[model samples]
Target: MQFVIRKLSPNDRLSIVTFSDDAQRLCHLRSMTQASKAHLEDLVDGLGVINMTNMEAGLKTGHQILDGRHSNHKVHEHT
Candidate 1:
């Protein structure tokens, strides 16, 4: 499989948190607590790195940081 990396906007951050929480909840319901925590933490950390990298790149390139999903608005403007 192929993968692409990019910056994440504020909204994207929020969505990531929300999704992670939801997944954790589902995992708990399914009695997969260990997997849930590990997966969520990994996802959160990965997104944090992506966000930082993207923000830096945007600053260097003089371009707005855009969300991974919605590319219409600036990353900082999402919140």
Candidate 2:
């Protein structure tokens, strides 16, 4: 897998929102804090594609698969 980061623009906003919402739903998260939501939006803006196989195996599991090959930009924040 490969990871690539792309700049965000107004055009991608809807896709980002949809992606974030899907992520939240997949995790069964009740609600996201404003900061968290903003962070996700920022992530989508500074979009990157991560090759999952390149990530540590421990970090790859379960819903990580659904998250696709990219780790959420806020992954480090969570850790």
Q: 1-79 in candidate 2: lDDT tens per residue?
A: 0021134333332123123212221222213444445555565566444433223332343245446544433232122
User: On a 0 to 100 scale, what is the lDDT of residue 73 in model 1?
Assistant: 34
Cα deviation in Å at residue 41, candidate 2?
0.4
lDDT of each: 0.28, 0.34
- Candidate 1, 1-79: lDDT as tens digits: 0011133222332122212111111111122244444454565555423222333323322321122333333333211
> Can you give the TM-score per candidate against the true fold?
0.24, 0.26
Model 1 alpha-carbon drift over 4 Å, by segment: 1-15, 18-32, 49-79
How many residue pairs clash in each candidate at the backbone level?
A: 0, 2
Task: Report the error of model 2 at residue 35, Å.
Answer: 0.6
Number of the top TM-score candidate:
2
Q: What is the lDDT of residue 4 in candidate 1?
A: 12
Residue pairs clashing, model 2: 1-51, 3-49
